[model samples]
Target chain A: MTRYTQPTTFYTKEHEWVTVHNDLATVGITHYAENQLGDIVFVELPDVGAEFATGDDMAVVESVKAASDVYAPIAGKVVEVNAVLADKPETVNESPREKGWFCVLEIKDGAEIASLMDEEAYKAFCEGL
Target chain B: MSDPTTENLKRTPLYDVHVEHGAKLVPFAGYEMPVQYPMGVKDEHLWTREQAGLFDVSHMGPCFLSLEDGIGGGDEAHAKIAALVETLVPSDIAGLKEGQARLTVLLNEDGGILDDLIITRPIGEAAQGSLYIVVNGAVKDADWALFERSFQGKAVLTRADDRILFALQGPKAVDVMSDFFPGCEELKFMHHMPFELSGTSCIVSRCGYTGEDGFEVLVKPEAGLPLVKEMLTDERVKPIGLGARDSLRLEAGLCLYGHDMDPTRDPVEADLAWVIQKVRRERADFPGAERILKARAEGPAEKRVGIRPLERAPAREGTMIEVDGQPVGIVTSGGFGPSVDHPVAMGYVRSDLAEPGTKIDLMVRGKARPAEVVSLPFVPHNYKR
Candidate 1:
C-alpha cells in the first residue's frame, strides 16, 4: 500500500484528492485514481493562474495503459502547476498525495466540497469496487 | 469496472487470481487481461526489468501441423508438405531441424506481410511428427484459414485452444525457472525444453518478445491456475498487464504485428530480412519470394525506424512524421517508454531519411515536435546467450 502524508481531506467523484492549506488546495490523484491508472508516465497540468468552473478539466494524466483527464473537484483558479512532474511523473505512484500534487488551486467555491465524497464514503465506494 | 467488453470477454486461467490480487482487468486480445494489479505499470515494468513479472498470454494462438502419410512414401511426403506451406510463407520448412523453431512471415504475393509466426518442428516425442506453431491472437482466424485451405490433404492443422500460454520475462526469469526445473539453466536463447511443470507436461522456451532473458511456457489450460500460483509465490515475480508488455516490447524495439507490419508492408521494408534464411531466399519457394528477395538486394522505398519524442508529450499511433515541413511517414507505435524515462516510438519513413540521428518532426495534437530517427531498441536487450 502507498503511504500518504495527508488524510483524505477532500476528494472528487472522479477520484482526485485535495489537501487543504489555507485557501490553497494541493490537488493530486486519489489512491483509487493512481491504482486505476496503473503507472503514470506524463502529466499535463493546467497552466498556472488558469481559472476553471467546477468539473472543468484541470490536467491530463497518462498511464502506460491509457490517458485520463483530471477534472476539477471545485470551482477554483489554478495557482501553481506541478512542474516537478515533467521530470518524475512516477512520483505520483510513490508519493501520490504529497510529492505528486498536480496543482495548487485558490478555492473559489467552498460549497463544492459538500457535493464531493467524504473519506468514509470514498472508502466504501473503493471497497464496493 | 463497468465495461461491457469485460462482461463478454473470455477470462484466462489466472482471472480469479488476478481478481484476488486486486488486478484491474481489461479486455485485450479477446480476453479479460489484467492491465495492472495493485502495483502500477511503472513499478511493474521496472520490477520486470530488474526482477521478474508473470504475464498471462493465454490468448495467443497455439497450434500443431502434422504431415499425413501420403500414398507415395517418405521423401514425397516431405516435399508435398513443404510445397503447400511455402506458397503462403517465406521460410524453408524443408530444412528445419527436428525440435528447431524458425520465425517466419506470411506474405501476400505483392510482398505485403500477412502475419508473423514462430514455427517449431515438434517431432518424435510430441506426436508422430508435427510442426508446432504460434501466431498473433488478432489474426489467428486468417492464419488458420491460410493453413486449412492450403494444406488440405497433405497436412492437418489442429488449433491448441485448450492450452494456456504464459510468459515469465525479466533478467531473473532463468533464476525463477531454475528453482522449479533444475536443468532449465541449460536452455539457450530461442531454444525449448519440454518439462513437467507441476506434474503437467509443458514446453518452456527461452524466447520472449521483451528483449530480456525470459521464458514462454505452454501448459495445459487447466494447469494455468496452479502453475501461476506456484510461480508467483517467489517474491521476485509479480503479475504484469498488457500495458507494461507494450512498453517493454517497444523499448526492446520489437514489432507489434498489425501496428508495425501489415498486409501492405513487406519484410524488407519492415527490416525483418534476418528471419528469411539464405537457403529459403535462394530456394525461391515461398510466396512473394521474387519480390522480397529483389527488395532485399535493392532495398525498399521505406524502412522502419525508431523515434525519440523531444519532450514529455507522447506521439501516439497514426501521428504524422515530417521532415523539413513535408510529410514523410506516420507513427505506427508510439508512447512514453516506462523503462527509458522518455517518450519513444517506431514508424516507417522514406528509406533515404531512415538513418539514425536524422532530425524529424512529429505532429502531435496539431503542433509539431522535434524528433530524431534513431536506430531501433531505444533500450538495450538483455537476452541470455
Candidate 2:
C-alpha cells in the first residue's frame, strides 16, 4: 500500500513528468511522449536503490516501430518501480498519466523541481511541436 | 521535431493524399515517406494480414531493359535480352515464360549481393525483348550506373520511377483490386500483364514483398492521384506505411537489402540459393561464380536463419549472438512481430549452429538474453499458387 500527500506535478522538455510530495518524486513519461511512441511493447525500468543524476537515462520504452530512452528529470535515488509495466507495457499507451507511472524517487534537492514546467506550460510546449 | 532536414527530402506523387489521411512522414531512402497513419504500425500491420493494405512504393526503381539495336518480335529477341542480363545475375532469365516474373539479386564480381530485385517478362508479343525490372530505391543510382557500364551500346535502360508504383496486398487484395481491374484473378503468383483503364495504361503484377497474395501496379503520373484516391474508398483497403511494411516482411522472412545481406554476403550464405537455377550452377558462369559455387558445395562459414527472443524484449540489428558468452553470430534485423505476438528476428550464425533449436544468447544492452534459432517465416506465406 502507498500513502498520498499534497502533490504538485512538473514537466520536462524531454516529455517526462514528476510529481513531488515532500522529499519524494514520482516519475513517468508524459501523455504526449507515449502517444508519439505508439503501442509500446516493452518498458525497461531502473532498479530500486539505483542512483541517477539530472537528465540521466533511467528507463527504456520500446514500440513496434523502435525503441526510445526515458531520462531522469532530476537527480535522485529510486525507491520503487512500477512492476505492472513488465507484463503490460501497453498501459503506457492506454493510461499514461495514471497507471503507467514508471518509478518513485527520493529527491536530493527540492530546488530542481522549479526548473520544470507547470501543466499549462507543458501543454503549450507539446503543441509547438 | 526536424523541419530543416525534412525540407530537402523528396515527396512522392501521392504525398498530398498521405498528408490528407493523417500520415506521420519520416525520412526513408532519401524520400519523405509515411511511417504510419492515424491507425499506427501495429494495427496497420495486422490490418494488412486480415484485409488488403495499399502502399505507396513510388520510391522504388522501376525500369524497362531492352536491346539497343531495336527489339524484334518472338522468342529470339527475349533470348538475346535475357542473355545480356544473365551476365549480371545468377537466375535463369532466358527461361522466363511470357508474363512470368522471378525475384533475383544483383551480384558483385565476388558474388556478393548488390541488391535484390524482380525481373518480369511482359505478355504481349511486341514486349518480348524487354524485361520489367524493379530495384531498391536507396541504391537505384548505383544500379543504373552499373547497368550503363555493363550494357553500354548492347542494351538500353529506361527508368519509369517518375511514375507512381503502389502495392495492394493481403488476403482480400483480390476483392479490392477486382473493383478496379476486372479479370485480375486470372493472373497467377509471380505473373503480370498490362491493362488500359479509362485512357490510362497500368501494369499489374501479382507479387509483393510482404509474402501476401497481392498486386503491384505501375501507373502513369497523370492518373495516379485520382486512381489511388478511388482505391482508398474501398473499406477493405487502407493506406499502409514503411513501419508496417518492415514488420510484415520480417514476419515473411524476406530480406531487406543492406540489412539481411550486403556486398560482403553471397546468395548461399543468405539462404537465397533457391534463386540460382540448376543450369546456372552447372555452367558456373556468373560474377564471382567460383567463390559462390565453392561455398555452395562445402557450405558457407555463416548462414542466415530465423531467430526468436525467448524473453519479452526484442533484439534489434547489430545485436551480437553468443553461446555461453562466446560470440558466434549477429542479428541483422529484428523487432516486435505484431502478427506473431512476439519478437521475430533474422541473423547470420555459424553454419554449425544454424540448425533450428540451436540455443544462442543475444547481447542486448550488455546482457545475454536467451534466444533460439528457428525456421524462416514466423508466419506462413499466403501467396496464391
Candidate 3:
C-alpha cells in the first residue's frame, strides 16, 4: 500500500480511462470509445471481488454495431461496479467521463497506472489514429 | 499498414451526396459506402420505421436478361424468356404475370443456394422478352458468370449497376413517392412500373428491404442525383446509410446474403421453401430438384429461425446455441435491434428445436444467456399488400 507517492488519472492505448486515488481506482471507457462504439445496449460487468491482471479482458461492452472488450488497465481486485449501466447503457454515451463509469477497483500497483498516458498525451495519441 | 483491400474498392454515384450529409464511409463488398450519417445508426434506423429513409443501393446487382434472338411478341415471348431462366432457379418464372416480381434463389447442382434474387418481368409489348433481375452485391460477379455460362448463345445479359439504384422506405414513403410519381401510391406490393422522374423514364418498384411500405427506384445517374437531392429537401425523407439498412432488414426478418444464406446451404435449409411454387414443385425440372424436394418432404437437418435474447446481452454471429449443455446451432446474424429495444437474432437450430417459444441458451462471451426461438420479423411487416 505504501509503494508510490502522488495520485493521477491515466489512459490505456485500447481507449479506457482510469482515476486513481490512494489505493482505490475508478475505471471507465473514454469519450473516443463511446463515439466509436455508437449506441451501447449492454454493459457486462465483472462480479465484485473478481481479480484481474494488467491487460486482461475484464469487461464486455455490447453496442448496436458489435461487442467490444474493455481490458484491465492494471492489476486490480474488483470492489464495486456501476449497476446503473444495466438499465441505462446509453449513459456511457451521454457522459462517458463522469457518470458513465464501469467499475471501481482496489489497484495492486501504483507504478502500472503511473506509466500510462496522461490526459494531454492521450489526446495526442487519439489524434494520431 | 498497407491497405491492399481498400485499394480496389469502388464508389457509388451518390458518394458525393453521402459526403455532403456527413456520412461515415466504410468499405463493404468492394465499395466505399456510408455505414451511417452524422445522426448515427440507432436514430437512423428508428426514423426509417416512423418516416421515410432514402438509401443509396447502387452497389447491388441489377441486370437485364433477354432472349438473344429477339422476341416475336406478347405473352409467348415473356414465357420463352422465363422458361430459359427457370432452368437455374426453382421458382415458376413462367408463371409471373407482366410487371409482377417473385423472390427466388439461384441454386447449385447439389441443391445448395448460390444466391437469393428478385426477378421481374417487364409490363409491355416492347419489353416482353426481357426480365429485370436483382441479385445481392457481394456475390454479383459469380451470379453474372452463372448467367453468362447458362445463356451463352441463347440470351443477352446486361449489367445495370452503373445506373443509380435507391430505396425509399418507411410508413411515410408512399406519401413521399406520390409527390414525384403520380401513380406510385397505387402500385401494389411485389409490382413495378415505368415512371417519369427528372424528365427521364425510370423504373419504380413497390418493394423494399425494410418491412415498411416503400419504393425501390432505378434511374440513370444523371437523373438519380437530382432526385435524391429533391427527396432529401422534402421533410419526410432523410438520407439513411448502410448501418441502418442492416438493422432494418434484420428486424424485418430479411436475410443478408453471406450471413444467412450461402452456397453450402440449400434454400430449404435457409427457410426459403416458400420461394418454390406448387406448380414447379409438381413439375420438378429445375436444378437439384431431387435433393431439394427430398429436403422439402423430410425437412432439413437444421432450420433458420428467429432468436430473441431474454437477457440484455446480444448473441453475435458465430455465437453457439445450446440446449441441456449440448450444442444445437449457431447464430447467423445478431445485434441490438433498435426498434425492438432489445437484442434480436437469427440462427440455424436443429429441426426439433426450431419452433416458436422453444427455450434455448446463447453462449455470449462464454456465458449462457437464456433465449427463445420466436417467429421471424421481430417487427411486423407494413408492406402495402
- In terms of lDDT, the best-performing candidate is 2
Q: Pick the candidate with the highest TM-score.
A: 2
Model 3 scores a C-alpha lDDT of: 0.92
Better of 1 and 3 by DockQ: 3
On a 0 to 100 scale, what is the lDDT of residue B216 in model 1?
86
Docking class of 1: acceptable
User: Which digits, one per residue and each the tens of the lDDT, describe model 1 over residues A1-129?
Assistant: 222345437676688887765566788898778866766788888888899888887788887766788888888999888888988888998789788989988978665666777788888877776
* Candidate 3 local lDDT, A23-122, one digit each (tens): 8889999999899889999999999999999989999998888899999999999999999999999999999989999999998887776678999999
Residue-level lDDT of model 1, residues B254-372, one tens digit each, is: 99999999999999999998888788887877778788888898988899999998788888889999888899999999987877888889999999998899989999766789999
DockQ of each: 0.48, 0.74, 0.67
Q: Which is better, 1 or 2, measured by lDDT? A: 2
Q: By summed lDDT, which 10 consecutive residues of candidate 1 chain B come out lowest? A: B70-79
Per-residue error for B125 in candidate 2, Å, reads 2.0
Model 2 clashes, total count = 0
Residue B233 local lDDT, model 1:
86
Which runs of model 3 end up more than 4 angstroms from their true locations? A1-7, B1-4
lDDT of 2 by residue, B290-360 (tens): 99999999999999999999999989999999997899999999999999989899999999999999999
Per-residue C-alpha lDDT of model 3 across residues B1-385, encoded as one tens digit per residue: 2357768899999999999999988889889999999888999999999999999999999999989988548798888899889999999999998899999999999888899999998988888889999998889999999999999998999999999999999999999889888888888999999987668888999999988899999999999898899999999899998889988999999998888988888889899999999999999988889988999999999999999999989899999999999999999999989999999999999999998999999999888999999999999999888
lDDT agreement with native, every candidate: 0.81, 0.93, 0.92
User: In angstroms, how far off is A48's CA in candidate 3?
Assistant: 1.5
